[model samples]
Target: MTDHALQSPPSAPVRFPPGLIFACLALLGVLFLPLPETLPVAGQRMLAILAFAVVVWVTEAVSYEASAIMITALMAVLMGTAPTLADPAQTYGSSAGLSMALAGFASPALALVVGALFIAAAMTHTGLDKRIALVTLTKVGASTRRVLLGAMLVIVLLSLVVPSATARSACVVPIMMGVIAAFGVPLRSNIAAGLMIIVAQGTSVWNVGIQTAAAQNLLTVGFMDKMLGERVSWIDWLIAGAPWAVIMSLVLVALVLKLLPPESDNVPGGMDGVTRSLAALGPMTAAQKRLGGVSLVLLLAWATEGRLHPFDTTTTTYAGLVTLLLPRFGVMTWKDVQARIPWGTVIVFGVGISLGSALLSTHAGQWLGAQVVEHTGLDTLGTLGVFAILSAFLIVIHLGFASATALTSALLPILIAVLQTLPGDFSRVGMSMMLGFAVSFGFILPINAPQNMVCLGTETFTPRQFARVGLWVSAIGYVLLLVFASTYWSWLGWM
Candidate 1:
């Protein structure tokens, strides 16, 4: 997402926010709920801290960066003071807890997220992203249908390079807005609404396909690495995710077009506006050429992971970032990109990992997983049944929280625990990967995702308008996931 500070669109109206309600209940739970015999002192305290983080994050009662710092401090004092199971005689030192809180910063997954931000900054700095977007958009005529398709193409192209969905949407929204102006239609017109919704929805579609596309995906990787002792490589993720993303991309365009048919069949001069935007960019500069080459190399490195090269995605991304920041060879300077880096995101992401790590290391995840298995009887279900229930659960829970990162941080550990404690012989890694994909289903609300909010800020569509399309997308997308799980994914041995 773009600097989240800028992406704050108006939210869904309510007498009370979900976070406030959850926070009150969470407080009650902490004060009254007895610790289970199977759960540790540390585990119980960790749950309290998790609840606190969830309330703060979901409510936006505080900035996410601030909440991360608060979580870190909470972990240090709370977990630090809890008695160790090994020898209730000893306590985890506060300093040691502090280190645990900051552990996510050291993760290779965090490194990749930072690298992606730098790459995104570079694309913006060198004008490569806008140039590329306009270049693709200009290719399709200004006809309303093709304009929608062109928007999707720009979304796909940028999702590959920009990595952050909010940032990708930020880049494309203005360009689409320009197209709407060129068409000589009101920004409130159906064509304008469809294009904006497509841009918003398309970013989400690709987030599922690419591993580096969203920070939450990286958080999933960090958990897999720390909890599962293995990680899904880049190529494998794409192979499993791309076909689904490709089909959904088509679905997104078709549904938006259907629900919000354009004001006119052919937007005469629509192509002209996109063309003028491209022409105003003039010829691509040398910096753009350099950035483009580096991004392509970085993308190739990503696609070839565990295949043509032994290097992990994080390493290759940093190598490319280094090229962009080098003295003479680099496309950008620290001064040029520093402000756009969204340091708050780094803080939130790091602490989120630390939070989840604390959960697993404390065996809090295991205890919770055991309870879920025992109570839900997920143990009795077949693999497909498990996926359906979990996927549906994720979609439902997603409604309460706005940030996918926060949702993943709070629930993924539990979900992972759920999978771990479930009895039977199913692919744990595969289920984790698919479940991670489910976390991206932030459809059904404008505020459900930051990217959606970015487009919402354009005022091209109302939240109700966006939600209408989102309802269809989420329902159909859910069904499509099941179909893929039963057939294509099974054929690929992913399930």
Candidate 2:
């Protein structure tokens, strides 16, 4: 491989994007718009800030962390109608401002994400991720088709523990590159394209099946529990979402294989190279075994939290992290954990939660919900019709949002508000799951998700190829999920 090919995609130099200027002007327009006096002052301010934040996030005018920080500052200043000197009992928005701007930092959901990151770090430090990938890959033997299945299986299993799609991709991609190299597959060959696409898509596809598979999934659960008072357990999410997750994962494998077949059907030396790589790693280390045990126990605790009612998910995750950091029983050090976990992700979630809470507090969801339903004529549709239409709309909406968490955090409140207007008993949990999972299905572009970007970075596949194949995959996935939502979820009393 060329030196340049091995390096990450080059970063562009700092320059002002025209989109940022437009976003600023748009925010000013919203702030100064002359409207009737019926709208709550707090709601208007919250809505304007939400619109501003959305534009800034979608346009990539600034880093996500910077946007989040700016959001915190704006919430405190713009949303507050009273002076700081005012007493709490006398002030209208002072307490609201403080709570809305800083509530996310105190959220248990944020704590869960932090703890989950430590678990991921332990997996990396102990090389458990590599061992799992190798063992799964070697079991499938040397046939190209089998190897592809093996790769998909590894990503699915890894999702149960790794939680982050990008982290799972990071672990699986290196193993795939080793397999491709061992077989002497050309860097630009069809085999390389198939392998790379599956690794990226597989990790994303399975993210919905497991509750802890992605940070956004956890955030959705938290939103439901905290905002709606509908606690969606891990087992509940798995029961409702796993069917589609499995189906879509297999669909991706078949789609990529048909779209980009390997150069040859079989590896020259069969599973020999893959097996040799696994053998080279020697037996599982004591640390790997220990981490595995801790992960398994943690997974069980989350899965049973709904029925057993033990410590909450966040508490369980933190307890596990503490176990991992113990001097003798633990597998990782605090310093190593700090280096491995992305602290910025915690910041993003904290700010996002704070903002979502502000919207709910100011009744922004109810106001915007009424407007969307009225403007879009959603109230006129039948139950299943609403599902299909909204499902399609949500799937396409992914084009405008950059991060899955941002997309969910921005739109979910509105969705909840809209559902409340419906005549029948609608499942907030059901709709929330649909919206959260749909954002991750941003197949039209590489910027949709980190895993897609990781795959594109390999340079074996182009955006054109991904779009051509992804367009149909995304369409089919949307339809398939809607069908299940209408038929299966309805029978189960979820709709």
Off by over 4 Å in 2: 1-15, 82-98
Scored by lDDT, model 1 comes in at 0.86
C-alpha TM-scores of all predictions: 0.94, 0.93
- Model 1 residue 282 CA deviation (Å) reads 1.2
lDDT of 1 by residue, 1-495 (tens): 568878879897757656656765785587368877888888888888888877877677767887788788888887778887788889988987888889889988888889889898888888899998999987887688888888888888898889888788888888888888888998788988998999888888888998888999988988888888888988788888888999998998899888898768975576888888888988989899999999899889988888899999889999998899999888889999999999998888888899899888888888988888898888999999999999999998888788898898899989988988887887788888899899999888888899999999998899888889888889988998899889888887767
What TM-score quantifies how close candidate 1 is to the native fold? 0.94
Report lDDT (Cα) of residue 180, candidate 1: 85
Q: Write the residue-wise lDDT of candidate 2 on 1-495 in tens digits.
A: 999889998798977877677767776787788743545666777788888888888898888888888888788877767323234344456566866798988888888888888888888888999999999998887888888888889998898888787788888888888888887878788888888888877777787778788888877877777677876777787887888888888898888888887779977786677788899999999899998998899889988885787677889888888889999889989887678888888888889888888777777777788888888888888777777777677778878776888877787777777887666767767777777777677687888888889888888788888887788788888888778877887777677
